[model samples]
Every structure is written in C-alpha cells, then in structure tokens.
Target: MGSDDQGNNDVGRSGFTRRGFIQIMGTGAVSASLAGAAIAARSKPVPPEKVMDAENTVKISLHVNGAQHAVLVESRWTLLYVLREAFGMTGTKEGCSRGECGACTVLIDGIPRYACMTLAVEAEGRRITTLEGLMSGEQLGPVQNAFLEEDAYQCGYCTPGQIMAVEGLLRKNPTPSLDEIRIGVSGNLCRCGAYTHIFRAAQKAADLKKR
Candidate 1:
C-alpha cells in the first residue's frame, strides 16, 4: 500500500479505538468507585452513642383506677396495649382496633375513650377507669348489680364497654332516658342482641343512684 494511504487508514482506526477505549475505561472506573463506596459504607459500624440512644427506653406513669403504674413502653404503643400487656388488665377488649368498636372502652377523666385508639402517652397524668376498677372491695359497684338484675349481657364480651358507657352517661345526665341510654351505648356492639337488657341496666343504675 502507498505510504499516504497507510497513514490515513492508521489515523482512522486510531480515532475509533481511542474513543471506544476511553469510554470503556471511564465506565469501568465509575463502576469500581461506586462498588468501593458501597463496600465502605457497609463496613462502617454504627456509632456506639447512636446505638445506645436508639436502644434507650422511656418510662410512662399511668394513673389507672386511682393507682399509679410505671410502665416501660414504646412511644407508639396504644393505651389498650399498655393496659392489657404491660399491666395485665385485660378487661379492655380489642375489637375493631381502629376505634370503631367500643369493646376497648375506658374512662378518661370520666369520659369514655377508645383505649385501643388512645395513645398511652396521651393518657399521662389522666385518671383512667377500666372494667377491672369497677368493684368496691368485695362488693360490685351499683352498675354491676344493675347489669345482673337486668340481665344486661348475653355474650358478655361487650358487657364491660356497655357498663362503662352507662356509667359515663349517668355521670353526665344523672338520669338518662331510655333513648338517651341507647344512644350512649350505641358505640358498643353486642352481636348477641342484648341491647334491650343493656338499656334497662342503665335505667336500673340511675334508679339506684337516686335512692
């Protein structure tokens, strides 16, 4: 081949080779750098201080049924969990966990609240009344006696919530009519069709309070 032609061919091949070689080398270096960074990040240990802080827990004091219980719980735990799991007071039943069912009912400052939906932290320094606290020593509270007299419960799973609601209603209205009592206990569900007896129980409680 002629010298000029050979020189031109060499330049053309060199241009393509240099472009492709640079691109391959650039890609390889970038990949290697990324891999090294990922490995280094994985190898680095979490600081002891950070780990300790993350592991640290908080103490919560609950005034439940006129008694104080200091419990250790996560910040996100609901009052129902604290009452049931931490304190062993399982009277607060778990039903419709998102606050629909009143099975997890408890009194906060004499008002009915869905314990499952109420945060334990929110209940700090508040007076809480659970079904466990319904009795006075060996004798059942007036509401309890009324429940028995009126045959208020069929399944009894909703009895605690129903009674709590009745107590709150009487506390507010002092003498709730039958309709008022029904509306008050509406949040509670008795799948066994005991609502009529439940309403009668509330009236009985009101009568007992008057006498």
Candidate 2:
C-alpha cells in the first residue's frame, strides 16, 4: 500500500503531477473570472445625469460693438463664428481657426484676444470690439486711417487683426517706441511681408491719436 501511494504522487511523463495540474487549472479559472468581472464593470452604462452637455445649445447675451445682442449659440461655437455668422460681421477674417494666426483677433474689454480661440459663451457680459466696430458713422477710426495712409497691408488679409492689435497697444501706451510697437503687434502675422509698413502705421496711429 505504501509503494502504490508513492507511485500515485510521482510526476507523470508530462512532468506535472495530478495535484500540480489541478492547481494550475484552478488558478487559470480564477484569473478568467477576474478578467470577466473587469470587462463587465467597464461595460456598465453611465447614468444620464453624469453625461456632459457637449451638444446642447445655450442662449447668451453678448455685448459687442457697443450694442447688446441676444443670440442662441452652441457651447462650442467660437466668438469668430458668432461674429461672422450670427451678427453678419465678416470683417473679422478667419485665417487659422487655431489662435496662432491672429487673423481672427478681437478686443475683449479693450484687450486684444484671438476670437477663434474664444468661445461665444465666454464673451457674454464682456465688451467686444471687432474690425467692423472701428468705424464712427462710415468714417474709419484713427488706427484704420493710419493703416490706410501708410499702406500697411499688402494682401489686407491680416490688416484687421494688425489694426486691432495696434488699437489695443495705443490704448495702453499712447506713445510706444519702435521696439514697443514691434512687441505690441507681435502676435499678428502679415504673410505679405508688410512688417515695415505695419510698424510705420502703428507709429502714425500714435501721432494721430495725440492730435
């Protein structure tokens, strides 16, 4: 009886005893159960209340160009899109939808900001000035006049943003030096290589504001 027990405990030709094979099978079954539990947890549906409002439209009042506009806009709608589409203020060009181009520049509370990057909902309760707002009863503003006189733009695609940047700069520093002027409009890019004229126009705008 002792010899028979010893033979039963010995490793088989497959190198695994009956007890060892049973242990491995049990471990594999446990691992499979854990994996199935994890998969089931991940597949569970999220509650409706926990969902985000990414697709919903919201009504917002925007104070733009010294006027109040009550408009319905989606949460993701950009200020640039609202200005051009809803308000019909297409003067604010859309070059790079990304903020890098500065083509969609606007003034929020007298500060230059990229409208393409700014959401329409964010502009609520803030004063917004676009390229179209820089006109006084069919007459161009001082900065616009300076740009026109100096021929600051070649293609004129970047002219609106450049003018707005200069306007914001001169509001803070009425007498900015050449270097200061360069830094002021640095965010704007003129693909027409009109930096020289643009800088000259900014200087002229400073002088014009003084008069």
Candidate 3:
C-alpha cells in the first residue's frame, strides 16, 4: 500500500488514529468498570449493626396524658400507631397518615404535632397528650366543651385533632384573633367543611379557658 494510503488507514475521517481510538475506548471501558465497581460497593446492603433496622424493637417509656407506660416499639413505628395500638388511645385519629391531614394531631410537650409524622422513639421522654387526654374522668375539657357547644365537628373524625390544636393554641395564646385561630388549626383538615364552626369553636375555647 502507498504511504499516504497507509497514513490514511492509521487516521480515520474523524481525525482520530485507530490506535488512539482504541486507547480511548479501552480507557473508557476501564473507567466504566471502575465506576460500576464503586457503585456496586456503595450499593451493598448496610450491615444490620451499622444501620438501624426497621424491624428492630426498642423499649421506651412514654408519658401520655397523666400516666406513664413502657412499651416495645419498632424503629419505624409512628406515634400514631403506638398511641392507637399500644395504649388503645384511638382518639388520635389517623387521617392521611402522611402528616398532611391533622387527624393524628397530638400535643408533644404541649405543642401541637402530627403523630403520624412523629416517630414513637422520638416521644420516649416527651409528654404526649391525645384526644382522650383532654378530659377529666368523663368531663370534657374546656376546649372539648367549646367544640361540642359550637358544633365544631361534623363527622367527628378530625375533631380530636382540632381540639388538640386549639388546646395548644390557647396554651400559647389565650386570646388569639380570628386570623390567628385560622393559622393555628390550619394543619387540621375537616373534610366536613366545618371551618366556620371550627373557627367559632376556637374563639369559644379561648373564652372557656379563661373560666
């Protein structure tokens, strides 16, 4: 073959020599293999001892309402599940179960929180107040009474959460304005569209708390 033809054979139309192309392809293959190896190493299942397993159970003491109880719970167990199942405090309703709906509202350290979003282990040493906690031996608390008197709830599924939110709000602000009341229980969603009654109940609750 002519020298020019031989030279043309060494370099392709793309300006890359055959050997250079081979070397680049080989380097890319090696790099891809190394990257795959790194990914595989990273994707290996974490050791059970190194990571918290969801099935692992831990014993924890929870202060609920005015009582204390010890229970074993999985790391993945939500406060809503523990309250409903362990203590049978089903008053804390599980609405959305994703923290979107306020049906599972509870007071943790006297602050309103979504029980479904709270892990059971996190409330170990915290004071948890459910819907039933807002009662005195069959006598409804002021917030509950106001809710009842104002007819705040329709289906009553979200009532517990609403009451708890109001209780927390009143504890922080005894006299919240209408807008403040709206923002206070904004997390709780009443599917019955009883927002008007709920707002009135919050105002009534504030008054009832003073008495």
Per-candidate clash tally:
0, 0, 0
**Whole-model lDDT per candidate:** 0.70, 0.75, 0.74
Models 1 onward score TM values of 0.72, 0.74, 0.74
Specify the poorest-scoring 10-residue window by lDDT in model 3: 18-27
Tens-digit lDDT track of model 2 for 39-153: 3365432322222268887677666666666788887899999988987777789998988888898998788999999988877656788876676544567888787678787
Off by over 4 Å in 3: 1-53
- Candidate 2 global CA lDDT score: 0.75
C-alpha displacement of 122 in model 3, angstroms?
0.7
Error of 1 at 180 (Å): 1.0
In angstroms, the error of model 1 at 115 is: 0.1
TM-score of model 1 (CA atoms): 0.72
| Stretches of candidate 1 exceeding 4 Å from the true structure | 1-56
Using TM-score as the yardstick, the better of models 1 and 3 is 3
Cα displacement (angstroms), candidate 2, residue 43, comes to 49
lDDT of 3 by residue, 116-138 (tens): 99988877656677777676543
Top of the candidates by lDDT? 2
Candidate 1 lDDT tens digits, 1-211: 1133224333321121112212212222234334334433644323222111333456776667656667776767889999888877776788889878798899987789899888787777566888766654434567766876776776677778888888888889998888899899989988989888888889989987687
lDDT of 3 at 75: 88
